[model samples]
Target chain A: MSKNGFTRRQFVKAGLLTSAGAAVGAGVLKPTGLWAAPAKIKGPVKVGYQAIMSGTLAGYGEFHKMGATMAMEEINKAGGIAGVPLEVEFRDSTLKKPQAIKNARYFVDSWGADFLAGVDSSGQALALAPVMAQLGKPLMVTHAATEKLTEIEVFKKGIKEIFRICTPTYQDGNAAAFVAQGLPAKKWATISPKYEYGYTCWKMFKGTLGKLKPGTEFVAESWAPFGTTDFRPHINTIMDAKPDGLYSVEWAGELITMIKQAKQAGLFKQIKHIMLPVGAAMDVLEGLGSEMPDGVWISGRYFFMFPNDQRNIDWVARFRKRWNHYPAYVSETGYSAMFAYKQAVEAAGSKEAKAVIGALEGMKMGSPAGERVFRKEDHQAMYEVPWGLTASNPKYPFKVMGKQVVIPPVEFFNRPPFEGPGTHPPFKG
Target chain B: MSTKATYAIYLGIIAGLAALGLLGDRFMVYMGMRVMLLAIFALGYNLLLGRTGLLSFGHGALYACGSYSMALVNLHLTQDPLLGILAGVAMAALFSLIVGFFCVRNTEIYFAMLTLAFGMMIFSLIWNLREITGGDDGLVGISRGSVFGLPIVKDGQFYFLVLFFFGLTLWLVHRIRSSAFGLVLAGIRENHQRTSFAGIPVKRYRLAAFVVSGMFAGLAGSLGAMLQYNTDPFSAHWSHSAEPVLVSLIGGLQTFSGPLAGSVVFVVLREIIERYTQNWMLWFGIILLAIIMGLRGGVMGGLEKRLRQRAATRKGGE
Candidate 1:
């Protein structure tokens, strides 16, 4: 609404209402005619998606696009959702927070997107929470693995419209701790990124690992800032500490750099047991190639070769055939999010944001990643992901996960109210 | 154009922008607010580049200082936007004065390099001081509380607040550019040695212009943080510093309103192109290349040149 007491949006909406009313009335008048029933769903449900589309991380955006595009085509081909077509528009959110917010506004206000999806950075995800509330639209986060978006924003702040289709930091933090407790290594040290994501994951890993093993000692820690290309000093710190085990939460290019440097420094040989929370990421594996030493334990939000189910295999084959490249975790999550939206929209029988959100709560759907259920408490999708040791494989160019260990979401995910011993993960720091 | 006509044109633009804030939809208002902030930043920046002929790359440091100071004040002290603005502007002015004291000692490439160095220093400081600055995640959840008891929590209302500041900055910059001090600064740009021989403290004038330019950057930065509801360390990065320099260059380094026109094209054009293509940066780069190469001077400079030639032709015909 403007100062003049009306807006073009309101006027168009009113006109639509009148015409819809007349159509309903005409349908009622023609009981025996062809137009007996009015359409229960709206036409052309618009979804706006955003992701990092430039710079070194630009590949993430391309993979995200492939999955979402494939899902959109598949949905439309199947007579769309509830007899109405699904429209999706992808915008580059970049790495900047302002640009991310601008893209969100562009989606809802300019492009008339009813539901929003795909954010790559935790900063962008957290920032968009307030704006999503203001816009009164549902944002399905696909890539960003921030715990705060669910544990703090949605669960505590009660921002109902926020939902995560992918696993949060628990997959990177607590899940790794669950995997670590099984190993015999008693002393641990880490070389992680020097930001919130790194801090949170390291904290979760150490706390949970200590809780699980009772006598585990965190020997030394090295925090590498963003854009860190060298890891010799950090590796040396870990080597000097002579920890029985090592943990690192670094991801993407930085992780690749750290591993390459660590391999060169013989740091990998020095520590018999090592864990990389995000080491199974496609980019890291692809980047490291043969340089990525075998035997390090790793896990990710979604691994394309996981579950090993027929559905997973078929989806991976299709994705590879279409893209001529392996599906990254973001690709899987992006594809799954589209289907999630479709199921919610069709279940609710409406394209309205509120209706879709209501339908999405506690909804269970089978995806390439196996069965995923959106937790009613925090809207964080709960599922199982496998942690495994890296090993050479002839089937793929890079090392594949061997001796996989699966961690259930309920075992480690921070519960609602996110505080105290029972509800939250052990908080020692 | 005559003074009266110029005044009228400025008034018209202000009125038009105000109308946009009142009548435009949410997105439009938000975009309008962005353009106004850029305009404010560019306007002040042009004072140093166009009026004084000095290029200081460290203005972004001043901007970050202002943004962080204002955000800290709002977060800890008062939610009053005016007080935040004052804190932002004061901090920027003080910081710029200190930086200008050193930077104005040299001219040309040396000064530019000095400013760039300072800018990156601030960026690293902001990045490393994670406890205070929030690291790369930035300071989020900032609210536009109110202006003298009038709530600007809504972006539409906040648009008016930015509009007021934009108008104020424009008027101030215009006054500075046309004043006697402006001419002396222009003299300094044309030839500092000659200006110094004429008994004017050339370095003092340069320092003054630098501080004023920095003050403007601070104002824009403070408002920008409020508008975006956050401030990040990137705001102080050299890449961020390049925005004003690029805007001034593309708009016209020699014209008063050149950077203002450039900012409009810079922001709006990118927004429009982004809607059409995913590879917006490539297309935007191509367009900017054409503008920079084809237009000899900037957009405003080229237009002014054409107008001058046309007037000369009319006189010859008469």
Candidate 2:
């Protein structure tokens, strides 16, 4: 035996043989086998991100990628979740539910992702609830603001894996009604999208506004279909009704078109108090540019200018520098989702689904959208996003929100046992 | 290939799929299921496009008919997957009969446009009929209940069911392709005017082919809905209709196994490209363009030509 308890010849033989064996093993074996170990916190933290990466809505995916990539870089730089390296793979979800499910399955089953994030469409989000439950991975929904995802899937159906970092339809409907109640305009008219989203929001807005301020009338409503490029008829219908206030749930390019057509038709002049629940969306604001009329009440899932904290302000600057554009509401949500995952993973000290979910439930985290708390009941993140009046800012090329109205999320968010009178979407007129 | 060799090849393929179900991971099994479903769809679609030389673009509506009917059955009636699938087939057949009646009168581009119009109409119906069809959100939470006491909710378990259906579709399509009706359809494709002059009802044959093709699309859609446990109006969209066309084009239109080969390449390649890059569409488009441009006859077509040449050289050597 040598000084190390082995003879010199034995040591040399062992070292050379071991080196040869290792070289052979490295070539033959899967890398996953080399790294994988049964532990509470082990292996690289893998996140499978999916978003609309095709068609007209593809821009949203890019914004999501920007925010998520930034978070990933920052987290890795800061030593990652529980000292494990964080990795994210982005897939194009394409607004198709099957494709979304396939992407998710590929992430969790094939790629062995610890967490999932970034769904763009409400339909796709809702469709994923069962699949996510089956996959048994935490899905931190960054966008896809269908209340049904939380209320129906997570709350009623008890699919605990689903969690949304972004605000739901309450921001578009109940919160809009909360802000609108303060206005002198008692009679409200709407030109909304002709779908479940449009209908649900209009119903919620009417129900809440009526409750808040009695004698509030939904005088008239016009609904435009999904791909309505022309809104002249919808504007004309609103003009004929001649209500005191106009509330529209038309979002994205549709909102831009509606606003442009309304402006041309002088419908904005006719209706002095106008409210667009999704008007403050960066796409709509940017698309309309200087053409977007000022003083119109608008709200979004997030407003970059509001939450005027150092964190949010710094984030906006960083995002602008990184992407050369103002952060869309989805960007903030996407960024926040990564932080939420980090916080939960670090707190739990485990990448296991149940542990991370337990860590997430009722957990509070600071974000660019201000302090967000994942609701214990439904896994919906309760966060503050202001409803404000659209105004021009010297800093921006497009219209910005000026007079901000921040509503507490709990007041507008549907409580658990969501079937009751107050908790429901006022589905019955 | 000899009949025995063809049978052996099909058996080998089925065995491979069965092995995949038994041994492959969740994602592989799931993707295998998808490829099988698309293969079924493309096989039936090739009956019209390859066999009869008629291109109908409204097959997606028929596909949607199957999916929605199955989902509706699951939601409202019984949770039996078999019954739901049958309902899908029935609905797809009925709708296709109606659509094919109008479409069979015209040939070529006019037939394609009629099908497109009909497909969009169904799409609009699904989109507008919120209460019944669930509108844009569609019907979610479709239960994959027990089939013969075997739980199929799991991807690996459900894969065998898809494999079984895939085998059935392949066999059925093979039978149809070799039948007298298949010969008549081929003759019509070569010269419908000449076939009509020979006292054959060309329109009836076209309608039969269309309905049969639609039935296959519906079967694929039904199985697809079961696999995913959700159905949406997008299934009825014109874009969805184009998938079978693309698959058929990719596999080899004239060959029997063209769609099967095409489905595998199309699905697997898209998935692989998507895994690597966010610009998967661009990459997939480029790859698809290369395949389409380089191989005029598709992957199977190219394979057949090479195989024939190899066999000729072997005979020359002999």
Candidate 3:
């Protein structure tokens, strides 16, 4: 009833307020963050996340927080789960395992968080696995790609309550193999930093690529100690191998530094084919920028330019609009894990750990990465890993995953959605 | 005040705090346990740097050895947590026997560098040995079982246990400071050449101090791992070794109660700062610099001087 208008009865008889009130109410729902509804949920669902939030790997944490905050915000604004708002808490791991485990416990024991997620370091993830069962809460690993986390190691100890939304390291190798199938250069050699991650990824890539393309003569292998700054000697050794193609398993800052060294050594000009399994990651692309030379084959867990779906485009646009940067693969992983947790909570219709675990088993959800299903048996998500050739464009800075080689999840996985050799299963599920 | 009286007052304060914790927050008890453990670490570290004039840069390796030994034994061996704790200290002592021999042969910077090299070696080993040590992934699932037949499921009980150990360690340090052996170590710290001339085996005394300090550190490490529920190679890294040194410096190396006060302040400050800002490390650095610069001889030294001046003035007035 307007102030200057007549009585409410007369106004109602004239139907003066109904249409206006309805239109305004409809407008209210259109904007984000105005979701107001009576909650069916009993209480607020609190999520605690641990990651490498300090030291050299803090950027990873930044992306993780951004992605996680985005999801939590969206869900909360969209009337929340069962009409109850979601909350998030974060702690820095300092890139150390003990700190991560302590942080996880603090969240569980001290803060009474409903669930846990966000591990950036593979070491931290592995350490958190067995303890997660003791903690009795689900730990959805957002970015750690180590195979043993979901495979025989956890199985050996009979550990559960651990699920990974990101693809495993073996899948990265498989994607590298798929891309190698199209290249003309047959002669091959390997160069990589010496570590479990490097050794496993290169070993699987060799096996798969060799299986796909025969007569790929193994020439030479050069290994660099982890944290080796000067790559001149390693580059010289690779050039001396005189292979037509080279596969290097390295990532992040070390990879970026070596690429500059390789350019100075002119190894890219010398070799007709070259590839790095993680060269196209958002950090790698944005990190190298114009320094990322042309013609090198690279891959990412998820690249912004690949597939070009409308959903992905919208996600990327919103990310750029918010962070002023393309969403990294790790960002997508964090984003997906949060959504998966939300779905599990909604499907269970309760926030109890056991109930959520039951609901999450074989639960299906959509993500910016793509549609993914959480396997009931081993708790692994079967998702695609894409690889592509590097190309420069005047429209934007940094290398785009141009000439994209989209590898389907089925090609690498052997009878997935349960047990797969790619997931490093000890036995057939 | 007399040193004995000071200790009596300190004990009374601790007992009061423990009593208050029975009705207060369990989180406070846990924090108290952490503070006590840190004091133990600083106490062990001070034995070498303050009493013996030996600056070791490799305490991290010994510290980590203690935790790993405890953690592994708890996971596999007897449910008796006391045995694990003893084993942890024993392992560190044994390691000290080997490492201290080489380290004690040198003095000053050479000794420091030797300890550093050894520490880094242990760190790398922990980082690489994925099969046995779990590499950087760390050893998890450490059991927080009982020492005797008494079960410790409550935070209050654990805090009391830690307090008991801390009091014991402090008493041990007190005894060592007044004993003949302790005087010889002090003499060696003052003048190793003169002490050698006075028919004392200076090198041997230094080595013994190193072993004893390692044992104390091991005890603290084992207790820390049990309380925290995990131990990693990062515990063996050089930076972890620096913590006690920092505490000893910020407190007063010469004062008996300095380590405890410093530990309480450091832990409390860190926890509180973490709640406020993500860049707490920066704030920590600023506070550390202020303490280092503003205080004359660390917190204890400055406080003691003020007390002595006040006593002199009161005596004059009387």
Give the top-scoring candidate (DockQ).
Answer: 2
Runs off by more than 4 Å, candidate 1:
A1-36, A426-429
Candidate 3 structure quality by residue, lDDT tens digits, A1-429? 668878968868667555665567687654224343334467789899877777767888998898888888888889787667888888887877656766776788778889999887777787787567767899988888777777644444556688888888766676677778788878788778766677677877777778778777768787776678888888898899899988887778888888999999998899989888888778878889999888888876777775577888899998889889888888888887878888888888888898888888788887787778776666778766667778898877887766766666656753333353444211233
In angstroms, how far off is A126's CA in candidate 3? Answer: 2.2
For model 3, state the Cα shift of residue A53 in Å: 3.6
lDDT for position A218 in model 2: 86
Interface RMSD of 3: 3.1
Give lDDT: candidate 1, residue B128: 81
Cα error, residue A42 of model 1, in Å, equals 2.1
TM-score of each: 0.93, 0.93, 0.86
lDDT of 1 by residue, B1-318 (tens): 999999998899999999999899899998998888888988998889888888878888889998998999988898899999999999999999988998999989999999999888889888889789887777877778988889998988898889999899888888988899989989998999999999999999999999899999999999988988788778898888889988988899998889888999999999999989999999999999898888877999999999999999999999
Task: Mark the regions of model 3 whose C-alpha exceeds 4 Å error after superposition.
Answer: A1-43, A152-158, A181-189, A206-226, A410-429, B2-7, B13-33, B71-80, B140-146, B149-164
True contacts preserved, each candidate? 0.51, 0.80, 0.31
Native-referenced DockQ of model 1: 0.57
Worst 10 residues of 3 chain A by lDDT: A420-429
Residue range B42-129, candidate 2, lDDT tens digits: 9999999999999989999999999999999999999999999999999999999999999999999999999999999999999999
Q: Chain B TM-score of all predictions, in order?
A: 0.98, 0.98, 0.96
lDDT of 3 at B227: 74
**Which residue pairs collide in model 2, if any?**
A2-A6
